[model samples]
Target: MSKPRKPKGRPISGWLILDKPLDFGSTEAVSKIKWLFKAQKAGHAGTLDPLASGMLPIALGDATKTVPYVMDGRKIYEFTVAWGEERSTDDLEGVVIRSSTERPTEEAIRALLPKYTGVISQVPPQFSAIKIDGERAYDLAREGETLEIPAREVEVFRLSLIGCTPHLAHFEIECGKGTYVRSLARDMGRDLGCFGHIASLRRTFVAPFGEEDMVSLADLVALERVGDEGERLAALDDYLIETGEALSGLPHIAISDDQAQRLKMGNPIILRGRDAPLATPEAYATARGKLVAIGEVAEGEFRPKRVFANH
Candidate 1:
């Protein structure tokens, strides 16, 4: 029999809400953080395009288990749409495929808002990460292949126009998961008869995280210059938010130390007391304010679906 190889690096766990800079890919940010923290595992909750900037919540070690909860949360984006030409990629990065001299008045744009707000079907941009027949849509697009991407329902909780000039318009949107801001710009341009593309886009919020929680890339880089190795690692560790913070949107239950131990061993704990929840589809269990497991509450017991290691 062969012994299992232990994973390399420290088993650090928590979330890092990054203020992703423009032109930095989400995967690149995760890699950089993982290397800096020397963590054994890491992942990001959402995908932010290289062209976009702002809040990107990254999970390290045990925090990766809570990524789905964060990804399903609402997001807010502020973007600028430049009227005149529509690009093949639906952003400044792509070449112009259609052009129009026409510009929609502010009144016309405001009137169009109602049509896009709430539940509406949106087709993702051609140069997108969406998979098609086991291949990426963007890969096919780079090869000069045009595909008829299907439209899927996305909800825009709120969509408002901030300001506009003859050639440009600024807007802010709060939307549900799977909403595509690029598609919104393209469809709006086509509707107003003033072909347009995303000039700039910034995500100010993603679910439980907001602008206030974001740490700039420059700030993280500066920590590397700390004189002592121990101090430097400590400085970086200070920036990590608790793993349980990502599950703030979900129902939470506090358990005893004994119960926490039982959960760690993958055993269900019986719910006692009248205050205990009878049932919940999804909930998180914590002991002494530290996350222990994410589980389902049913049949008067808390059944763990995913367990987390102690920090």
Candidate 2:
């Protein structure tokens, strides 16, 4: 018997703030959502480990262009650190390399928060996706190769001790790009002399989105399973946020349809006359409230860098 052909997804667009469940990798979640929506193109704003869960912003079609903005935005996470074991991977998934009976007092843990907040150097865990010599650091570590991953600066906006016990400490942290929670746990452990590792992690939100914006995969799957193709697509649309919403962080300039056409055609629009607002370094140009393009505004000219396909 011949194998059946795989169904090709439709030309769908916009974003899905998926409430990724624990144990589902970011890539797998993106694939599932893409299939559910039958999208033509898909990508995610950030990578979330299988061990972590919560708001994973998946971008479909033109929405992918705005992924960089969301990725660069701050992230908030609530995680638990089991304070007696140190692991090779810096999380529960790895082998325990050391055990400790030491546990810091609540006051002690809180005192260390200031030390980690703001710009601080962090050495990523050996078992991580970071590339070294074109090979994944985790792959190298699994092969028993020792790696000296250099410490780099990362920003932690806020770090708070939420709750704690003799063996477990819970924390909520808001951080900027390149900040690794696993590394934070490892260093916090060393600083406390308790040798802890991440036990559980849940990303509450990524900037431009929050927990309120998230929809669980099971909810989308339930909608898809119960209806015909037409109805399924309609139901899915209820959750698909508009692509323009992702660019909300940037200042928007409403241009004339003619200006939008010129911008789309890769021609600079002269921002002269009374209607033109003062130029910003960069801005999103919209025509009748629809995103036309993203561009640099210099000396009264809108120079298109990334143009969006008008729907």
In the range 227-276, model 2's lDDT, one tens digit per residue, is 58899888998898878778888877888888888988899998877767
lDDT of 1: 0.94
Q: Rate the local accuracy (lDDT) of all candidates.
A: 0.94, 0.89
Indicate the residue-level lDDT of 71 in model 2: 91
| Cα-based lDDT at residue 6, candidate 1 | 97
TM agreement with the true structure for every prediction = 0.98, 0.94
Number of clashing pairs, model 1? 0
Cα lDDT of model 1 by residue, 1-311, tens digit: 99999998889999999999999999999999999999999999889999999999999998998898999999999999999999999999999999999999999999999999999999999999899998999999999999889999999999999999999999999999999999999999999998999999999998898788899999999988888988999999999999999888878889999999999999999988877876899999999989999999999999999999862
What C-alpha lDDT does candidate 2 achieve relative to the native structure?
Answer: 0.89
Mark the regions of model 1 whose C-alpha exceeds 4 Å error after superposition. Answer: none
